[model samples]
Target: MTSPSDPIVLVGLPGAGKTTFLAALWYALNHSTDGGISLNALPEDQAYLNEISRTWRQGEPQPHTATAVFQEIRLCVRYDGADVPGELVLPDLSGECFQQDQWADRHWNQKYDSIARAASGVVLLVHPDAWKGSPRIADVARAEQLIEGSVAESQGEHVASGGAGRAGADESDQVEANVVDFDPLRVPAQVILVDLLQFLIGDPCFHTALRVSVVISAWDLLESRGRTPSVCLEKEMPLLHQFLTSNADRISCQVFGVSAQGGPYEDPRVRQNLLQMDNPIERIQVRDADGNTSDITAPILWQVRDRVVEERECRGIS
Candidate 1:
């Protein structure tokens, strides 16, 4: 059975701002008492968050995470005025590693794939600025050109792209990876996501609940265009949008717009903006970006309240 400490994995492409989001979330949950939420970490892990918070205080851009390593941090949380208290084990992963898992031949082959599969929920971050056309289709075409040799070549591509398994991976693995009869090419975000959900959900007997919170980072750029998060996502990443909307029966999802750093540090008015950010009862939950208040914490709030946990209970998932 799941406990209060069940983990939530954050997935997205590189530069999705997972690192910054985690830091900001830590600060908003811990330092701010306006809300009853609390996210506590061990002293050492707490120090890391503190450093990230300091960088925000200085109005400087924090360093990016190394693509291959993630320092796992467990956060003991209490929210809803302490009505719901749980533990969230967060892995600070670079976006490359995540999309790498998404493109894998067998998702379970990816590093930390098992942990992700067993996690209670997931949060996907997408950078509003960089989210353009689908790149997976081209990646698949390249794979087709490289596949004329043998089974070994296909396995190599999956592994080199960050999936697990070595040169002589099990024959059954090859079959399992190719089970989906969809196009070998045209692996859009929708396909990757569907595969991911199918793998995580497992068979009917192994069905477990999952929550996917898609956060559009740097929302300031889009809000200026008079579009909501859903509106922009539908236009920019329609396949992903349709996938989530059409599969409501399979997974629970919520879309949110967030601006963790508000705007770039290079902006001349950044200092003034930061100064004005203070005095809010909440920490950085709400901030005035271009000219409006953006709720960076809404996704987390929705994630916490999603029905994934309820589904797990109903399905009797261990």
Candidate 2:
């Protein structure tokens, strides 16, 4: 069980903007070394956490987003009439971790199990580019196996129809035959995957989480494709929304087109052009099937509140 002050875990593939989102989230929440925000209670082995803070403090910043190894960030905030201290932990695991035989260790698997149990919720970072390519049948199959296995180990039931998308050649029989013997009741109540690009056309994992939020990072780059932020989101949200809702009943998912980098990057040829400056304002526009667009900022404190604080309440953890 997690207290209101417990940490929230962020798990996803590499280069999925986990570290960048954390940095932006921290800044958005009005946190600083002098302002009573610090990771005083984190484990002693968390050197990466310290390094991230040090980079921001020293004015010589490095990429704090995702690394080959896991990292964590801690923040303190007031939300929903409670004074809360939150931590966001990003596992070092990349998409490759989902491959067969990589996650077979009992110790390794247990770490994620313990974290999920302690965490209020989860944010799964997914790369949009992975979705745009021809769907690797193997990738799809492995993702299904992973979700099925994880849900069973966690004791959660598979709520969506296993056969909804099976269109050809007895896939239902194949899925049933290959179904790993696992229980589903142990799965966590809230899990949201963040996608930097909404390109994984019709991928199935989005429906696995109780609620999914699709976020597009590097919004400025989309302009090169002859699409405005509003126009891009407008085109993508409907397809994603219908797919998720049509597939699952227990799951309630929404799409939010977001840009972590507020605008385009500076040209490299110019002498005064800085490299990778933080966006002063990050925007996320939430779009549902009803065509409602609600513009929200991707603030760290609020994200902690939404993903952690509220999740604790729902789980009756307080």
Candidate 3:
């Protein structure tokens, strides 16, 4: 199960905290990394890992990934009491590739196709504040009324002028402009995610019975309001929650609330408090469906180790 071609994939929108989570996971793995999951060997390429982890430990903000950047990370990792380590390959792709380029515009890249075909598991990240909900019924009704009034006024002008050719053309253009052009970026978060998952399941080359880790980043904001990861999913994004629940046979999922930076680093007080901590690992918090944990590797470990073992056992592999 550990190979270059078959890897666990990370998917999310820009600013969804995928990069931050990776940095925290790298830091957590190196400190008190035993008793759960630990890195067996670092990848030959440590430049990217070093840079991001440095910012994470220093309480500095991680730079947003440029849309054109696509980094593949390979970590040789092992779970406690496992016979051998597994190579966890992660493609740290730009979120735009998923939402804007692929799903929205249908500008599918062959590279993404290869990655999707070979992915063994998926970590889907979502920022709570980034959700773009569907337009309200009242708002839609109001827009329709405005368009109708404009058309009626245009018709009255046409009769008064008896041959308002240019005026009629301008009114037609206005009406056409008023007709909302679908912007792929504005598609509801849940809608895109659902469509993404459906693509995975429907595609013939992709693996079936996939395990997914739904991570809600910046969990500190929502945790303060006494919301668990599972509850947050159900309430905040019912469409995604229902889709996952309904398709339980095709995909098994676990929701995690990850506060990779503990709190927003933009806050001076928060940054100061984090800097004061002797161990920056303490600044990381991971909430499972059940409870909280300090291990930032929980989600990846579940995907690369736990599920891999389960799959092997079911096949009677000794």
Top of the candidates by lDDT: 3
- Give lDDT per model, in order: 0.63, 0.41, 0.81
Local error of candidate 3 at residue 318 (angstroms): 9.3
Q: Which candidate number has the best TM-score?
A: 3
In model 3, pairs of residues that clash are none
Where does model 2 exceed 4 Å of error? 1-7, 30-47, 50-68, 72-74, 80-95, 98-108, 135-209, 223-243, 247-249, 263-318
Question: Compared with the true structure, what per-residue lDDT tens digits does model 3 show for residues 57-156?
Answer: 8888898888888888988877754565767778898888888887888765677678778887789999987664565457789999998898789778
Decoy 2 TM-score against native: 0.47
Q: Weakest 10 consecutive residues, lDDT, candidate 3?
A: 1-10
TM-score of 3: 0.83
Clashes of each: 2, 15, 0
Per-model RMSD to reference: 12.6, 14.5, 4.3
lDDT of 2 at 209: 33
Q: Give the per-residue Cα lDDT of candidate 3 at 117.
A: 82
